[model samples]
Target: MTRVAVVGCGSIGTRHIGNLLSLGVSDIIALDPDSGRRDCIHQQFGVKTCEDEEMVWNYRPDVVLITTPPKLHLELAISAARHGCHFFVEKPLSDRVEGQDELVEICQSRSLITMVGCNMRFHFGPSNVKRLVSEGVIGRPISASLDAGQYMPDWHPDQDYRKRYSAQSRLGGGVILDGIHELDYARWLFGEVAEIFCHGGKLSRLEIDVEDSANILMIFKTGISAMVHIDYIQRFYSRSCKVIGEEGTISWDIHGALKFFTAKTGKWEVVEPPAKYTINDMYVEEMRHFLSCVEQDEATISGVEDASKVTRMALAARKSMLNREKVLL
Candidate 1:
């Protein structure tokens, strides 16, 4: 019975609470400033709720899940680390990297288990792409393209799009930061980025202050180059990736199949997800992995130190977009 405290009650927070319950971890305390959100989660899951952060510290949960907006992530995580609590923070570690080094130091000093929620790494399609690339199925990788886009309004039909954190600049809302899965997995597949150039901004009339689209080019240290396009203006949700190598190519579609083409064979092979796969399955598995790491006192797949690198990459992209010049990492 690992005690847990979830620090936000938005959609992601609600999903995590439900998943934690489904995984048989009953000791949960949900903290949210919104009374409506607190009441709703309590009614839905019967978990304890509180509006005060101090109350959560009093609960002395073994782990903390910081699902708040990006700007608030590092501050909350630092506090959790100071409390000697292992923590899981959502992606793009922070809107900026100002205090990340300190947070990493605190966690390292305490030996706390930390994980950043790059849940796409757990998704079947991306996971298989990673495995296939590592297995040399695509031969020596040379270049790749990654794309992800969806209408901002379609994200949550029940809520106003303008009210979401993704629509606010101060809250670290933008297609690049919000949809950083591409950059993360790009590094995972290829290698460290040597330089980056991005071109994008709020080209849509979505009533948001942040960039709604981005076209990023990355030069990897391993001599592999990749292009990534992310946008919040697509009428339909679309996510896919293609990797071209010396001998073949591989493609992955979130909604469809993973296809591999071999130059010698002249045939395309396909792989599909299990019959009962759902998007939420990845989130559940992500939480399960975090909890297992907590129990075993083992290092997580995406710890704070590794996530900080990605945050730096994201911030560099923003600098590139603002200055209209390529940034060297």
Candidate 2:
């Protein structure tokens, strides 16, 4: 029986715990500092809940899911690594790059199986886009565009949007860090970025201190360039990507289809996700993959070391926005 401990017990953490139970891995524990959150998970999922961090370590879990805010990620990860526990952290990895190298080093020295939650990579549309690019459906990719935005107030209707981490700077909230899925998948499809120029800031009337919008241009080491736009001001949720290649173009719409147009075919090709596919499916699949990798002591799709690069890119974009200059990686 593999024992699992999920720290945070918030929205994403609760989702993971439910997925774990559905996957039939039931030896689970939920950790949170909030008594209400701990009790809620205990009643909802029937998992053992702990209010103290030490109690989680005492449980001797083989794996710990660090779903806390970005600011708290590195510290919790380090503590988990010291306890000889493998961990899966949520996206962006951290708000800054200061302590990331240390966390990577600790995980490496322990030979622990680690994964970062960039679940967008597991989504059908993005996965197929990566595959089509790799298969050369769009020959010699030249330039690309990626955009994602959603109104912050509409995110969690049950709670106050102002209190959510996505709206707070100190909690690592902002479009750049919050929407890092775009940056991660951009690198996943294209190559490493050599330099980045970003322009945009908290241009909205949203009651937040962080930048609510960002438009970034990245020049990849492959000489390819991409334009990325992210914002929290859109009234409706929107996400899409278009990659133009020398011979063709591939595009993806979150609510639509995966499409491509090639000079060879002189027409458009479309691929749709399976009938029962839902956004939650990606989360479930990612957790399933992580558990399998942990059992086999194998590598994960998005490990800490590789994810650190994405965090670096995000930080660089912020740097560019603040300094009003292109940042070299």
Candidate 3:
């Protein structure tokens, strides 16, 4: 059995733990400073729990899931790499770019199988969009727009919104990083971004210290222009994207099937995912893929380098917002 350690028992950490258990990984341990969270993990999953990072690492786990906040990811990943343990880190890489390049180099030099949790890529909606764009179904994709928003308070009704990392600046909480799924999948579809122009701030009356909304425009090296909008003020949760091409347009959202509009067909066509598909299925698939990479010593779809690239893009967007100018990437 592969020994695994989950570094944090937050919401995302719990989700990953559940997936790992479902995938038959028996020897699992959870590490968190919160005794309540640790006890919850132990009681709910019957997994071992540790309050100290060194204690968790001493377990000699083959793999570590760094599901802590964006600010703590780098230190945990470096420690795991030093232990020759494979890593599966959650998204945005970090709140800042400092030390990430070195972190990636260390992981690569160690020949570690590292994966970043950008599970949106595993979703059928974005997966289908990537396929359609690559297959010329949209006929030379030129531009796109993506939007995602939700009420911050509703994120975890049981917890105070202000106390969570998403509402605090030092913890790397903000709409841009919190809803980074939009920026990540946008780049996945369009390719590397060359330049970006952005305008955003705490436009909403949200009581959080971080910005509540942001609008970013990116020009990709592939010559595609994309716009991204994220916010924590939307009363209802919503997410969608629209890709425009020379001959047609493709649009998709969380609750709806893929819809394509073409001048050639003079009508709209719908493409639905498998009937059994669910949102949680994406995380399960992501975990399974990561485990396969760890066992086979293979590379993952979203590796360290990919995470660094997206982190840079997210940081650039924040910079553009501050400088009120376009940033060249």
Task: List pairs with backbone clashes in candidate 3.
Answer: none
- The stretch of ten residues in a row with the least summed lDDT in candidate 2 is 91-100
lDDT on C-alpha atoms for all candidate structures: 0.95, 0.93, 0.91
TM-score of each: 0.99, 0.99, 0.98
Q: Give the runs in model 1 whose Cα sits over 4 Å from its true position.
A: none
Error of 2 at 147 (Å): 0.5
Question: Across residues 1-329, which tens digit of lDDT does each residue of candidate 2 receive?
Answer: 78999999889999999999999989999989999998899999889998889999989999999999988988888899989998899987889889889989999999999999989999998899999999998899999999999999998889999999888998999889989999999999997999999999999999999999999999999999999999999998999999999999999999899999999999999998999888999999999999999999999988999999999999999999999999999
Native-vs-model 2 lDDT? 0.93
Range of the 10 consecutive residues with the lowest summed lDDT in candidate 3? 69-78
User: Could you give candidate 1's per-residue lDDT for residues 170-260 as a string of tens digits?
Assistant: 8988888999999998988887999999999999999999999999999999999999999999998999999999989999998799999
Q: Ten consecutive residues with minimal summed lDDT in candidate 1?
A: 183-192
Q: Count the backbone clashes (under 3 Å) in each candidate.
A: 0, 0, 0
Ordering by lDDT: 1, 2, 3
TM-score of 2: 0.99
